[model samples]
Target: MFAGAAPLAAQFPSDSSEPLAHARELLRETPLVDGHNDLPWRVRELAAGDFDSLDIAVHQDSLHTDIPRLREGLVGAQFFVSYVPADLIGNGAARFALMQMDLIRRMVERYPETFVFVTTADGIESAHEAGKIAALTGLEGGHAIEGSLDVLRTFYDLGARYMTLTHWASHAWADAATDEPRHNGLSPFGELVVREMNRLGMLVDLSHVSDSTMMDAMRISEAPVIYSHSSARALDNHPRNVPDPILRRLSENDGIVMVNYSPTFISQEVRDWAVTRDSLVDSLRQAFTIVDVTAPDSMVVDTAGLRQAVAGWTETNPAPRAHLEQVADHIDHLAQVAGIDHVGFGSDYDGIDAIPQGLEDVSTFPAIVAELLRRGYSDEDVRKLLGQNFLRVLRGAEAVAERLQQEMDPIVATIPP
Candidate 1:
């Protein structure tokens, strides 16, 4: 455990009137399934995919997730993301994704007592009943499939329950929210990707996809879609967030928008600060004739000079802190817009660099639950937000897949030339 971190029992007091206590009791009964986390990526980065070197059995200060912290958070099920960067589109993206998936499976195998590898809704509940965290896999970028439906099916067979259509950059078929539009939304092959996923019971995750792509998938997918780690754009105005129109559409589609805790996505102030920082960095790069301004740290040749310049900028204009309340506010907005049954937590724990104040790490989940309780959310409503809603979506996808499999063959089409 990190220094000064309270013990699991101590984190929740015994006072009957305390919401934290109530929240703890509720989570004990209901599985708190987080839609996304990136512990596998962290393991791959820090230890070169060696779980023994970077042990999660005990507290590791460098990471946001650990076995002890997950237990304290009462996280019954977690989707460990196999995140391949957009830069790796055709350059062995599938291999990297497979490696990350292997890492998650190995983690589960390494700690059998703490985690149970689960690919179905029933498996999640069974693992939770047995007092184990259900470790599930998710593929973050569709580019990892290399424009092939067969590869997508293979990923599902390998235990990827959900696959985010795009990452930071748009690829051949899908348009990423952060990148310029190519196919305008999803190409013909992209629509087939959604259809194939529906037929295979894999949840279509729209977190980093563009608005058009999100709408197209929502229209094409027979199963309910999910923004696995997105906040309400009506709150923060970030492209990565779900807009009000999309939230309203969830009611008809019966999908869920798992709120993200990333400071830039949840806080308007933080979003604006990032915009200003990026603009300043770009201007500085132009002034210095730096070709690779993307490398923010020591990897670039302008390590010393650029660091000095950015350091001076930071000294004058420090970034504002994002509070826990701001995260709750986004959740509240999502519940209001998407309806109570359509919102849940997707705390992007290890995936994000900066976290909100109260939600510092995985163990801080109860704090958000307590905040919801304090804000007048009933126990039943809170239960839906915690995990029931996500499970319902998963079950919906499974049912859709079962029905579709009887009517359709595997999608064998390739990207059109």
Candidate 2:
């Protein structure tokens, strides 16, 4: 997005006097509290839930995340994602969700020296003070609850502090950003879900929900909501990105939008290319051996054929490129529309295969902060963007939870057909 910006690693000077260096120093103090990272799901995919297969305690070139890389990035805390393929909605979503949570808990248990399990905002701070990476859990889709309030509460009790209302597909209660509007917005059950989330102190995530769903949840939620891994739609017009109006509404609701680093969500050209590619994949599904990729967990296609075909399509239609500056651009747009207090980092790492040009892995966060410095963002504002805004939102949710448990009754009402 910067006309001809240098590589991310080169953006900052090694010298301590430079502003970039100053930004790095600030990160050392507060550290980046990333809203989302999908290393757990990546482990599930690669090792079939075998925790011993991957040694994250050391550097893992296979992953976008590793201890060395996270330390280099100065990531103080992370919300490790428990993402199940949306197609598992009716089949084994709840079970899958539990398995993913179990994996995260096991990961923390295995690497106690590197990761400290954190559930509350206070715990996050305490872990940081103790010089450990605070590990928190977040469920990626509402389907993980299987439309049961009891299930939702159980997930909360299991250390999941936030749950995105939808993923790439719609569920019984909420609509997804990428799916055709089935509920138009939050169905009656969806509204009940939001209210229950508020009472339970769980942060209601709106990243994959449709705009109307976002509005509906914002209207009913007593606590602040979060766009855990979304960018600005006004910049790229992708459904997965948040619209400017919603950013405005976010400010009023006292929430934050963690900018997504996914190339399609950040670049209009890439989004356009993706639309065409998806159509081709659909056609392939019809012509060749079936693999309901729409339901990733259940996909049973000609893997060799589909992979080769998709690779060919990519070769023919080159995917558009995106850079960290564009990432900064989205951050700037969010701050401009929603105010600086409402913007933060939520890179969907490991969850996505494509990386923006300059943002290769966890180690590259300094370059992003350095670019923000080049854009003349004050050090304080940059710090807030890095992690403070998210921390504030976390603390706010804790306070809301306390007030809610005392002031309000849990919604046990169900949606009527």
Worst 10 residues of 2 by lDDT: 1-10
What total of clashing residue pairs does each candidate reach? Answer: 1, 0
**Off by more than 4 A, model 2:** 1-17, 283-310, 413-417
Total clashes for model 1: 1
Best by TM-score: 1
- Per-residue lDDT tens digits for candidate 2, residues 34-108, read 999999999998888786788887788789998889988888899998997899988899899999999999989
Q: What are the lDDT scores of the predictions, listed in order?
A: 0.90, 0.86
Per-residue error for 327 in candidate 2, Å, reads 0.4
Tens-place lDDT per residue, model 1, 1-417, is: 112224322543434348788889999999999999999999999999997899999999989999999999999999999999888988899999999999998999999999999999999999999999999989999999988888889999999999999999999999999989998899988999999999999999999999999999999999999989999998899999999998899989999999898999998999999999888887776565545657545233455676789889989999899988898898889888889889998999998899889899999888888877766677788889999999999999999999999999998976532
Candidate 2: Cα lDDT at 169 = 95
How high a TM-score does candidate 2 get? 0.90
